[model samples]
Target: MADQTPNSDAYRRGMVTRRSVLGDAHVDRAQANTTSFDAPFQKLITEGAWGTVWSGDQFTKRERSIVTIALLAALGQDEEVAMHVRATVNTGATREDIREALMHVAIYAGVPAANHAIKIAKGVYAEMDQQAAAKDR
Candidate 1:
């Protein structure tokens, strides 16, 4: 893997992580929307975020989920935070991770943003739990 160029490895790993984290339907929609204007940006993120960072051995997916949730919340990116909260289930992140990340967000981002993010996280978590419960039955 290290022998390959960053772009190639990144693209490959990004595709894997993108599908695993975002799901095929969401990734398919994003791929369908890709245009010449945004292609480079998409590639960059794929390589940087999925390929290099996510592929690292340092952190487990669960840890990454926590960090990502905290960062997104701190940035006040509610939509992205919500998406990541949804992704957490697949990444081995439990509801506790979301709560802890939100706590961090409150300290770093501000109370208002954290509060809103908490609401969004709770809603996403409720849906996730309901789905899990239904599947078990």
Candidate 2:
């Protein structure tokens, strides 16, 4: 983990960005679950990944979402892939965008990786749909 302080500006900005992308419920759960052993790790991701990379203005959140999903898929990060796929709702990435990204992943990464990521994405979508349905009831 980076030697970044939790009170730093980067951490603060990252918390907002992380919450924006991952939702308050998820963020809150993650924070609640943070242990002393993993606290530094959490700070590193929040300051570096969320603050520096995600907070950059070059790519729209939608573009970042598509790229992140593809990279996570290629790397066989199943859980991260699903999390990012769910985050597409907040990022404004449509299903079509995710489909295209996975197509590229199939070609560039591997069919198996893309296939598994697609499966995860589908599962996340189903859960999201179920949540939406529950809200409507």
Candidate 3:
């Protein structure tokens, strides 16, 4: 096996998975925007959330994506909800699936939360669709 340092494997795996799910552009921008103050925060999420939970095989990425969308929506995390909604392309969660999940968010979390999430999700979907169309040309 190749030589590796402690935490290297997890960090490497996390970075790769994060890129795959979030896309290289988004991850690149995030890394570019990271400052000295928030560097540790970025590293923690990279190794912890992306490495451990996301890399796990218990639930397929699709299921995890749906759950994430719902939870983010419930929490009124508009930005995160939009980001995860974009991730649905890589995770195999469809627009309809997001809508269904938002319905649950409305019932359990509150209608206001779901309403705001829907707005964010719609904008993200529109932007993604535009990108896809541009690529096709």
For candidate 2, lDDT tens digit of each residue in 1-137?
33434798889999999999999999888888888799988989999999989999999999999999999999999989989999998999999999999999999999999999989998999999999999999
TM per candidate comes to 0.86, 0.93, 0.89
Candidate order by decreasing lDDT: 2, 3, 1
User: Clashes per prediction?
Assistant: 0, 0, 0
Residue 15 error, candidate 3, Å: 0.6
Which model scores highest in TM-score? 2
lDDT of 3 at 56: 89
Quality of model 1 by C-alpha lDDT: 0.84
Q: Name the lDDT value of residue 99 in candidate 3.
A: 98
Candidate topping lDDT: 2
Q: Distance (Å) between predicted and true CA of 43, model 2?
A: 0.6
**What lDDT does each candidate get?**
0.84, 0.92, 0.89
Global lDDT for candidate 2?
0.92
Model 3 local distance difference test score: 0.89
